[model samples]
Target: MATQVNPPRGMRDFLPVEKRVRDRVLRVIRAAYEHHGFEEIETPVVEDAARLHAGLGGDNEKLAFAVMRRGLEVDDLRAAAAPLELADLGLRFDLTVPLARFIATHRSSLPPVFRAIQIAPVWRAERPQRGRYRQFMQCDIDIAGEPGITAELELLAATGDALTRLGIPDAFIRINDRRILFAALDHAGIAPELHEAALITVDKLDKIGPAGVAAELAERGVDGERLLATLEAIRAGESTGAGGTLHGFDAAALEPVRELLAANAGIRLEFDPTLVRGMGYYTGPIFEIAHPDLPFSIGGGGRYDGMVGRFLGRELPAVGISLGFERLVDLVSLPEEEAGETVALLVDKEVEPTRAIAIKRDLVAAGQTVRMQRRTKNVTALLEQLAASGATHFAFVRPGDTAATLEVKPID
Candidate 1:
């Protein structure tokens, strides 16, 4: 019997071509970020289990992959009060929490106001589906210690530049504030405790529409039709303040956010009163990137003025945006691995090794991507194989052929 082999469920293994494209896309994204003066940083894939469960990662904390302790006796397991108690560490579910911890550990070494970039894989124990995965990459840029909307503007501009460079189609950001959401709930006569439940339904407004949200909210003992109408009015740039619906909402709460929205953020920003990121730590404006073709967002982030402070023992402001790398990979249409004129150096089996190396060096020095392959039985099949793998040109090396004398032919 043959054994069935596969990567872990919800995980993936990229083929050579797929990997090449991914690297290229990553490079483009990195360049865009660096152009905006954001420096890249790295953190351990695993963090202390306590930090992972620190109530800052929102629902992502629930999906963290716990790493059990290295040495646990049977008695310890029996004595354990909770499953996670046996685990000392967990794979980080998102980059933000780790970033917060990172700054706390490296505060003295970093600048007072630090702009950092992190591109890495994070693990989540999710029920994998089309766009969701157990293991996936997140590209995040965060500004820490700058206490104003400048950080938000910088993140938006930089993220927009990356999207532009990737040529993401019809991408826009929907902006909202936690304050706005709470005010909407309050104005709708929904109890404070039901705010979370109402926001959950509101986030689905696009998919379920007003009627559906009303139905769902009604089930929770709150009629939300008026709430949805008020949100719609806000979305249309109409103020409900004159009608007394925006009560408990400090107009100043939106002053800075309005300034952020009005800035030339380098991308379209639509104020959404119903937008809720579900991250409990978001203390201010939150946003998500939307595309015309997709039912879901590709990326988003917002201010968490309270998170970093929790780690550093004092409140420090921080905000970041993450590009949903997996979704971006699906949406991006890039030319497969175009690294200039690639040359396949087909060396005859009898050719001297030194001679082939010398020839390859010359082609490489000429700025061509060079790959040396021993001549095979079926030369045409070999050329086709090379061409399929992104070889654009080919050169033959025989016993006496010099690098200067060899003819380089186009693969096609």
Candidate 2:
């Protein structure tokens, strides 16, 4: 009996149609990033475990897919063992971390406010679900430089523009500042020490409703009154006044956010106090884009001013945003007819190699996916078989022809 083979859990193999959809999604993202003056860059999939550990904060430590040295044993004699002090690499958990490392190593060769777009796979050891996967591609855009809200707003606008262009309607770009959330927690009487844990709990308010969040808080040692007060404060922020004007509040900590929202009136921006992003490194404004009909967020990002500084010796203020390519594709319903045609190139065996190459190039140049025919005997029969295989366009190459021509023959 042969051993059964299968992809590991949480991993996926994309078929032709699926790859086409994914490629289309990436094309849109690449165009958007380039339009915004972001230069694309690639980094190694694996990095030193120490660097990955230091870059990603505490919670991510458990999620890292660490690699161990082969043939190393606990009982190996100290005299014969080579130093394994630097267990120098593991798969990157996210693109931003590696970008930070890249900047630090090549600081002299890069611009001051470096703008980069990275699209690559990131691995995690999390359980898979509908929108979540252990190995996934993250499309990231980050600007590193002077600390200001303009950079943040620009990224936000880019995200809105990209999704809107991708035909995703009814999507909301939810905005909130970590400082504001922290201040609200303070107002609600939650102790300073409990802020991180409380925010982590609050971040799940949407997924696990208010009741569920409150229960979670209690489990994490939050009492009923503080949780209720915090919830009420968040609700208050969601209301627009009778005159359709936003309610006034102290804007010192949220000044940057307020200005950006006021300027971008057309953006579907909303301020939700309960929007606590689940990353320990987010030191300032945090935002997430969500679709009303979708169960997961389409994209999200926040200011990580200290991340770059961790690798570099100096503070490199930076902000980045990542688009959930898979989730975005899932939300879009593309029309079948508008999709590109898949051409099956049926070539005669006696045809010179140059002719086959020429035909393939022409089809490709005309915006078609050309699949070379493998079998040559009974060409007509093969074409008939291919027609039933969902390929609509067929290119038949005879031994000698001045130019390729399409002959539509009625099937009997």
Best by TM-score: 1
Report the lDDT tens digits of candidate 1 across residue range 26-96.
Answer: 99899999999999999999999999898888778889999999989999999999899999999999999
lDDT of each: 0.86, 0.75
lDDT per residue for candidate 2 within 73-160, as digits (tens), equals: 6654354443434245788888878998898998899988888899989999888886778999988998888588778877876777
Model 1 CA lDDT for position 172: 93
Candidate 1 achieves a global lDDT of 0.86
What value does the lDDT take at residue 318 in candidate 1? 92
Worst 10 residues of 1 by lDDT: 238-247
Task: Name the TM-score of candidate 1.
Answer: 0.88
Off by over 4 Å in 2: 74-87, 234-251, 334-370, 376-412
TM-scores, all candidates, are 0.88, 0.82
Clash number by candidate, in order: 0, 1
